[model samples]
Target: MSLAVALEVTPLPLRHPLPTPPPHHVGQPPTAFHNPWPSFHQHSWLDALLTSRRNRDFKPVPPRDQLVKIVRPEWGNGQDGLKATWIGHASFLIETPKQNNNEGGGRGVRILFDPVFSDRTSPVSWAGPKRYTPTPCTLAEVPEVDVVVISHDHYDHMDAETLQPLYERRKGKINFLVPLGNAVRLHGMGIAMEDVTQLDWWEGVQVTVPTAGSVKLTCTPSQHFSGRALWDRMSTLWSSWVLECVNTSTTATAPGPASPLRLFFSGDTGYRYVPSEATEDTVPVCPAFGEIGEEYRPFDLSLLPIGLYSPRHFMSPVHCTPEDAVCLHRDLRSKRSIGMHYGTVRGGISQYFEDVTEPPRRFREACETAGMVWGKELALLNVAETVVVRLDLPRLADLDLEHVRSSKHTKYFGIILDLFDASLKKTLERLRLNTNSFSATLCPSLSLLAQMRKSSAK
Candidate 1:
């Protein structure tokens, strides 16, 4: 009988229901595009930050081990979980830390963030730009998920190809945590709204799944517009999320388990410096910076954008540069951040759209120049990258610089360079040897982009 008692002893904490946030207004969708050239407005700060055509290529930095299943245990069952894999362009398959069965805290579930899996972030594949490199991980390889957090309805962040398929396979079983006005679109795609939990800024739901354990998903504010088409911009809400699972002692000081473990997935956004003027009565504005800024909290893990930002005048207002991404980390007050949405893809859809195609090394340098700790502040991760941050410590300016600088992103700009060269070569071949008109007109734009890519590579 004593042996049996000893064998039954455990340290797994009792996980309880999450404490919900106060009620918030779920405002109507942003239904129109008033910023005629949002990119120009966004790029106003990229004077020295912009990468030139002289450098464009980047090295790939796949994680030492691509599997998070192996890394979660080190994060431990106490207050940490396994690390996660970041598929490029804002899609992540985060592995929650190990959980104790029936306790409501250890449920280690798979999650998808702003899943835009399609080749193009456009309504029609024909017009939008294609992904320069293949997604770090494909939709099929991912497993049945516990949650899907869609920040907004932008084509790049909330793609049809990605969402429709995930919904088809995991809709009923998966809890979809999305923003307001997005339910109409999700339902339009055949998902039941009941299965979907939509929220405005500062709102959240605590999910306790039999297999996945207990987790709290919270919607936070971002300073960017939303839309799948021109007419529908802002009609749908956009947001970032904080997914956390806390409390584990088998027993602790408090009656319930503690909830502090967190992962932040920033959907798609420019930096928060300019403060988006919400003309449409958007909910979720930061009270600290906006009308209600005091209520915001810093994120733990930030999945920030870092690509498609060329022609600064056009892309600034809509996309963040690598340097700007560093600033966002400071803005969000994240503990440890991972960089995305920069080099793996090309972006900037129109006067309205934005993307960051530049590498973050230079941006990191720029941030450091401005007194922000570069390697210590944020970690710029690449396709197929993973990191395990021990939740036990508070690290700000002392991260592994060697680890960060050593991490390399895939070089997608080679294709751009090759394409640019190929087109120029092809055009030259078709033209007469003495002809200058066609050659003169085409070379400048191609040359500038080429040089810019080249400079950025260095």
Candidate 2:
């Protein structure tokens, strides 16, 4: 389908369950979109420092052989394949599906997320949290990175040292997508402004490749604070990312039918925090994941944060525990989930109940609690190990198309109602504020979608 037709049929202003804040707040910093959760409490640093000092028995780092390995060629074999390699910390090299030889030998896109190759995750090299495990692959060893996504401005997530060498190697072809208010830092790092795309929560952009298809990058909201220095808290936005690759190929020789594969990357994030009286012992969790799943559920795969949630008192508001990560997996309706953000370095103020290496163990327990098999549906990968996800697009084609479309429309209508927090549907009974208004435009686009669906179904 042509871009024009897709635009005509596409739902206007994509509906979101969580409230979205504007990219910029004129005089002051922007607030967390929907929840009134404070990004960071002012007096928690002392508690965090004291907590860190109390943890005298740090776990020994994993063996070097177990932590990192040389990159094999098959990891880059992207045609009609999905693969992911965790390089340590929060960095990952993701290879998205590509069209087969029938589609002119299309190659899948390579996406790098929160790549930190430096020895330490701090403003200066000599101080801060150093990597307990070695990186899986060096910058020189990584396959050509088509896109790099920075979740926030934190040192571990956005490393200038890594970016410098990567830029020199890619020779300016790499595209960096960062959160809002981070362009300046990237610019200071010597990357061109045109090469960087900064986004706010809910904003998105589409990149089309001639041989393959189009990948939609959406900056979704996350419950996290950002600041490299003390004074700049919450000045820049932080986010989780959702990537939707819409395959456009059609032919007998293609790997599969043209179906869209959706993936979600939970950047450094905390579980939802519901506001309550200070006297309350526990912070209530929010329904943010439910809202995310409502729109982008049944993801082909998801990378969820499963570490750094020790000492619940200080970390609960800003980080997700293993159980919380499992819940997030359900909320996103992910087909497969791999736990990340642990086993590389320490995070947050208090020593967790479990050892640093205990995230996977806790994750397994949580999976059982959630009634999912550990290796089958959910996974906790070893550093440098690769996981391949094979998608059956043809099966998607056989689904009821119109029914799916109507469900989407209905979802948006419900979102509109939720936004108002009132029984406006009855009051504005005659208003064209529901799905009926867009029926004409939406129906035609499904015809094109049907063709893609049919191919995948084959």
> Best candidate per lDDT, number?
2
What tens-digit string does per-residue lDDT give for candidate 2 at 1-458? 11111110111255553333343343345432222444333336676677667754555556756542334333534224566777776888887777553233445667889999999888888988787776766678787776788999898899999998887666445678887788888989988887788876666777544444456778887777778887777677788998877666565544554667778898988764423334222343444455566577557678998887766555666777777786676556566678888878764453334367677788888777654556655776566656655555544431111101124222110000022313322322221122122221221122332343234334
TM-score of each: 0.63, 0.74
Q: How high a TM-score does candidate 2 get?
A: 0.74
Worst 10 residues of 1 by lDDT: 1-10
The TM-score between candidate 1 and the true structure equals 0.63
Mind giving the per-residue lDDT tens digits that candidate 1 earns over 151-178?
A: 8787777776777788777645676778
In angstroms, the error of model 2 at 190 is: 0.7
lDDT scores of the candidates, listed in order = 0.51, 0.62
